[model samples]
Target: MSDYLSNPLELFSVAGKVAVVTGASGAFGEVAAEVLAAAGAKLVLAAGKKAELAAIAEKCRARGAEVAEVNVRPTSEAVCDELVRTAVATFGRVDILVVASGKNDVAKIVDMAPERFLDVMDANVTQSWLVARAFTKQLLAQGGGGKIVLMSSARGLLGHPAGYTAYCASKSAVDGITKALGCELGTQGITVNAIAPTVFRSPLTAWMFEENDNATAVRKGFLGRVPVGRLGEPQDLAGPLLFLASAASDFYTGHVLYADGGYTAG
Candidate 1:
């Protein structure tokens, strides 16, 4: 409405915005941090691994972005709250939150102990909820609209034949939270959305990218379902992430932007 028609690229500019990225040590977390950093955002990165967190912070700093590192997981409400405080203390305000701190425990429902299932839920579902809760409180207090970009997976929409019982269940819960929060914060000008990628080049899935016979067979089998005829790369996620984190997606919320290569289409 303000008329940026002359330079539409402004829609994606996150210059000087403050962002909080959890799971800063993980695959998607690194992508989120680097993307936000390259897009000119001040960063507050959190993770359980101090060395990894510091590495991410250093990369962002190298990009000329101010970064605050917190070597802790958002496992509890108190820790989540403190993370928000750190953002404000370092950057004055928070504008975006990327909940990337989650894990997958691959075990069939029959073989997985109840404790294992519960642990996966706590890591994926409970932690995401806590971080979102803390970030939302800060956004409301700051009296401005914000963005909450949640990390989901193709497993959220499609069931896997392998041992993905816990992983699938957890991501489905993430989708629910994204929708619920989007509705609740709509009036407040905040947007909530998720990025669901099937499989990308990450440490956990690195074997699928190898040139060995096992990797080749597995890759071919998987690609049979992917209409795009290729596995996902990290850059495949960057655009969608930028869109959700910037003004380009101001009118969009409660949506899941699938970065999969059409794997979920069928």
Candidate 2:
């Protein structure tokens, strides 16, 4: 091995790499963009809103990283293709893709509308597949390997009786997609993985963590199940994300790295 490769820490360097992060406006997406930029990756941030994506781009730029912003919804193949094109046009090539855009609707199966369930599936599963497919095509064209990180939820691995039917089902599909794509793309030098996190303090879940009696009761119940005795933080995902995005995880693919504070360990 070369001198640079001889150092263990050097394996985690993403310096000079180009990355495209979808759902850049969301909480986890914001953290992904910031962390990747800090790790020296040039970034292209895409999300549903232009203003939000622009804001994230500005933050990333301040970190001394090159950043491009694209307003896009990854549900359409055309939009997904355009996102990859924009990244390649801006940064020459993409080395990483983080699909962090997803939606969850809290409704019991008995009361869930078909449209609502489909919406969650489209947002979480279908959109993720489209984006990954487009990004993979670009990676194949360039004849270089890349990393794809899909955001899943701990609910995918465990059942929840609290009206998480659609969300859980959608995330479960994401996990399957991650494994399937990993198997198909391994020979092409692309690694596919998912980060499944437990309840985190994101805008979507802010109500659940609010300083209210109901929220406190909910938190207490959740804490009892989590071995770590706390909820996941945005920063908690940074290290695992960076590891999977870097050369250190070259031999690892189709794996679900649970950042659930040992909630799934039992």
Candidate 3:
């Protein structure tokens, strides 16, 4: 108990820990890598974009983090297993995993092809499971607690007017996986949780942050529902990512921490 009271900040320290972040080139993934790197964790960054992955790797290296870049995506069991193996090979073990690899294909259900919906599910749901499975296996073999942070969205819980059937369905599945795996791994000292964010500052949504008419109109409507009265910034995710990735969130599992600025509360 004294350990909890003394140096509370120490609970958030991930220094010297090994972290594997998929989709390291994506918005949330980039922030995850940056946070882990700045906090002193060795990083294994995986993404399909070679150049972007290398850029992120260099950025982490600039922060004095030992980084291993893997030009791959968690599209298959073998690839996901390779991510875990690479982490273990480079850092001897993985203490944290951030499944940030996912995509959203917006189209009305009637207009969307079956293949498109399946693609979203494969990216957002199946890949999350694959990476978690691989990471859990490694954690069990190593005999220690680990953290798995899966990316979800407000869309998981709320519906959007603009063609989000595929995205919504996929994220809901991710939420389910988080809960199931969290319970499954609780006894093993491993915790599985997810960060479900609303619209935040990212390349895909950058236009909404602009000063144009369309941007202003969209922002106005979106902000009407957000009690915080603003969209999320990348910095908004830094704290949650750090919390879930560190000892601070040890008691939290099978949970979805929404970083949506109260967008879903109403």
Error of 3 at 254 (Å): 0.7
Q: Candidate 2 — what's its lDDT?
A: 0.92
lDDT of 2 by residue, 1-266 (tens): 55764688999999999999999999899999999999999999989888888998999999999988888889799999989989888888999999999888998889999999999999999999999999999999999599999999888888888899899999999999999999999999999999999878788788877899999998998899899898888898999999999989999999999999999997
Model 1 ranges off by over 4 Å:
none
**Full-model lDDT, candidate 3:** 0.95
The count of backbone overlaps in candidate 3 is 0
In order, the Cα lDDT scores of the candidates are 0.94, 0.92, 0.95
TM-score of each: 0.99, 0.96, 0.99
Best by lDDT: 3
**TM-score: the better of candidates 2 and 3:** 3
Q: Which 10 residues in a row give candidate 2 its minimum summed lDDT?
A: 1-10
Clashing pairs in 1: none
Q: Alpha carbon lDDT of residue 50, candidate 1?
A: 97
Number of backbone clashes in candidate 2: 0
RMSD of each: 0.7, 1.4, 0.7
- Residue 87 in model 1: lDDT: 90
Q: 73-179 in candidate 1: lDDT tens per residue?
A: 99999999999998998889999999999998888889999999999889999999999999999999989599999999999998998899999999999999999
Q: Worst ten-residue run, lDDT, model 3?
A: 1-10
